[model samples]
Target: MQVPYLLDVLVSVLLLLGLFFLLTGTFGLLRLRDVYARMHATSKSTTFGVAGVVLASLLYLRYLGLSSGLKESLIVLFLFLTAPVGAHMIARAAYRAGVSLWQGGVVDDFKKWLDENR
Candidate 1:
């Protein structure tokens, strides 16, 4: 009984962390200014949040003594593989759309490089 319950508890903790990252991502999207910042919020935090949730799902299935955890594990695999591509596309679009950074922001290496190349 205790062993089963402990696994449930672990799953719950992971789920909570997942939710925290999700909420954080949403909050960052709303609170931050500019397209670049919004992409930053949406891309990184949500990816990690989903990762946490997927890990929790795997544990939850394992705790249930299911015959396989492969399905749940696959969800995490899909997330890891796709999240970065989505972020890159978003960032690229924002750049082309001329979204500028906040005033006095340092490090315009990207712009500098583009200028030099063109």
Candidate 2:
């Protein structure tokens, strides 16, 4: 068994990374020029945040050898799968609602991609 000190440091580092994701998500939501950008920020940040926290919990539980129901595992997997879809839907809805990209947005891959999809 690894020492508690090492586990404590690991948990602390994980928490810091989680906090970084959360703050960046908030900043992106505020500073980004368009809804699509906002969605991209939130999707990427929150998925990682949720994954990190879930992984930490999973590790802690397993380290103690608890008979957990694997709920943490499920959460990590669920977020990983769904976050991108949710972001895509948000971007699509924004596009349909006529939210334009920022000035100098330069490339509209999503626009072209959507055009191709339809």
Candidate 3:
């Protein structure tokens, strides 16, 4: 039926999109000049990437009459909740430990904040 065909198309698109973002995150992790930039890239892109893949899985499972994808939904919820917070903690620790930004970085907002708050 057309419904199944549409679902297939949507799942395929989500998978491809997820894979693209995952690849981009990996590339940024390898190629970026500094930790902060690497974290930013990986956290943002990979979160969305994994979300897309999980959503696709959820849809396919629903199509197959599986149990409503509660596990996949939880995974997405936890990933979104944790990834950015984890990245922030790591970045803050790195900054406190004197990890310098890339030479080409344009902003030092955290540094300014620390200075202002001190």
Candidate 4:
């Protein structure tokens, strides 16, 4: 079965973009100096990366006239729903446990909000 050139190219691009985000998230996890920053990098980038891969799979399956895109769509949906909530909870826990922000970072809007609300 011969795939169309455009479909092949789109799949390749999406896969590469997904790989790039995944690698960037990994690098940030290893290199970031603070828990919040690390969480930000991992949650956001990895979710997008996974979504990109899922989207590519959905596209390829649709191109092949398959009805399996629903699974991929659900995967993307679940990832999008969970990643942010998980990150927020982790950050909140870290903050309550007294994790320090990076020394070089400026501005703590959340802290200010907390202080104001308190």
Candidate 5:
């Protein structure tokens, strides 16, 4: 079966987009000063990156008439559902464990909230 030209272009674009986000996330992980900031960058970028890649896969698979893209759809759904929540949980745990923010960090809403509640 001949794949459509537009579909091919779209898949290529999505693949590139996904790769770009993944690289950005990697840079963020390496360059960010603190755990919270690094976690924020990695979680957001990785989720979008993986989503883009999976979406491209789904489109290509659908074009090839394979499995109706159900597996890819579920992967995207699971990523969107878990990434942020997982990041938040990690950040909360780090904060509770007394991980200090970067020196130049100014705002600490979590600290304020903790102080007020206590």
Candidate 6:
């Protein structure tokens, strides 16, 4: 039996949204001026993009009567848990190494906090 049109449309939308996020992340990685900003773009967008793709796959598997939803959900959970922590560690490393922020960017709150605490 053929799949329903609504399922097809939903899958298409999810895939397209995921692809869009991935592409935007790639663009940001290339075009952004500072290490912190670039790291932010890459981690956040890639996490969302991969989650979307995994969600689409989960939905498709459910429609096909497959039992892989738990796997996909776990993958998304790991991504959500790790991406921000990874980004923060990288940014902190860059900061400790004396990587400067973008010229036009606003206040360096983290740096100020570090100064005040130390």
| Number of the top lDDT candidate | 5
Candidate ordering by TM-score (highest first):
5, 6, 3, 4, 1, 2
- Listed per model in order, the count of residue pairs whose N, CA or C atoms clash below 3 Å is 0, 0, 0, 0, 0, 0
Q: Which of the numbered candidates is closest to the native, going by highest TM-score?
A: 5
Give one digit per residue, the lDDT tens place, for model 2 in 22-96: 789989999988787788788899888767777777767777888483888888888888888888888878788
Candidate 1 — which residues are off by over 4 angstroms?
1-3, 65-67
Candidate 6 accuracy as lDDT? 0.91
Candidate 6 ranges beyond 4 A from true positions: 113-118
- Across 33-105, the per-residue lDDT of candidate 1 in tens digits comes to 8777788888888988998888888776676676378887787788889888988888898888898887757
Locate the minimum summed-lDDT window of 10 residues in model 1: 59-68
Task: List, residue by residue over 12-112, the lDDT tens digit for candidate 5.
Answer: 99999999999999999999999988997799999999999999999998989886998999999999999889999999899889999999898888789
lDDT scores of the candidates, listed in order:
0.84, 0.80, 0.92, 0.91, 0.93, 0.91
Per-residue lDDT over 1-118 for candidate 3, one digit per residue giving the tens place of the 0 to 100 score: 2348889999999999999999999999999999988997899999999999999999998888776899999999999899979999999899899999989988888889889999
lDDT for model 5, please: 0.93
Q: Is 3 or 5 the stronger prediction by lDDT?
A: 5
> How would you encode candidate 4's per-residue C-alpha lDDT over 3-118 as one tens digit per residue?
99999999999999998999999999999999998997899999989988888989998888886689998998889898889999999999999898999999889888988999
Tens-digit lDDT string for candidate 6 (1-118): 5779999899889988998999999999999999988997899899989988998999888889886599999999999999989999999899999999999998878888988999
lDDT agreement of model 3 with the native: 0.92
Global Cα lDDT for candidate 2: 0.80
TM-score of each: 0.83, 0.81, 0.87, 0.86, 0.92, 0.89
- Which whole-number lDDT from 0 to 100 does residue 82 have in model 1? 89
Lowest lDDT block of 10, candidate 2: 60-69
- Residue 9's lDDT within candidate 3 is 96
Q: TM-score for candidate 4, please give it.
A: 0.86
